[model samples]
Target: MNNQHETPEQKRERLRQEELKKNPIGTLKDGFNGNGNLADLVGSLGWKGTGILIVVLIVGYVFYKLFF
Candidate 1:
């Protein structure tokens, strides 16, 4: 609870846990490791997957434009 009282190992573990919480979808971690580009990431999922992703994005964009 108290950073000043935490040993170095405890602090490191706490920070790691916090990092995982911040990136539950692993997107941030993937980006940090250099696969940040959305197209590249989606391409890795194959044609069907890419198609699904594109459709989802387009639908989302349309909804956003219409609503906002």
Candidate 2:
């Protein structure tokens, strides 16, 4: 709990755990910024979520191209 007392490895692990608790939007931003692995993010979403996301993206792209 005390950063000053933590060894480098402990500090790194604490930070890693904190990063893992980020919300989906934060994770998405981190992925876009290249600070996080997108594969990990997609893996967290699982197949159902991944499928829905893809469908939504395709529909949005089609709608955008059709309207604007």
Candidate 3:
């Protein structure tokens, strides 16, 4: 595809992919530092939804432990 035909979002994503390949360790660091959508979703969920998610995770872990 030609750069001239690329949309703005497509250009940004292509650049991001190139940068990711050049600095994967930086990507991992950013992910661990919660510079991603998971953190945003958790924050947007508010305390009640966050608590419910934690409870569900705990239950899933217990089930995994029991079965595996």
Clashing pairs in 3: none
Candidate 3 Cα misplacement greater than 4 A, ranges = 38-60, 63-68
Give the CA lDDT, 0 to 100, for residue 30 in model 1.
71
Better-scoring candidate (lDDT), 2 or 3: 2
lDDT by residue (tens digit), candidate 1, 1-68:
88999999999878755755666357544744785665335534547866887899999999999999
Give the alpha carbon lDDT tens digit for every residue of 1-68 in model 2: 77789999998877665665666567666766788786656754658878998999999999999999
- List TM-scores for all candidates, in order: 0.43, 0.51, 0.53
**RMSD value for candidate 2:** 6.4
Superposed on all Cα atoms, the candidates' RMSDs to the truth, in angstroms, are 12.2, 6.4, 10.2
CA-lDDT, candidates in order: 0.68, 0.74, 0.73
For candidate 3, which ten residues in a row score worst on lDDT? 37-46
Q: lDDT of model 2 at residue 66? A: 100
Kindly give the number of clashing pairs for every candidate. Answer: 0, 0, 0
lDDT of 3: 0.73
Q: What C-alpha lDDT, on a 0 to 100 scale, does residue 31 get in candidate 1?
A: 44
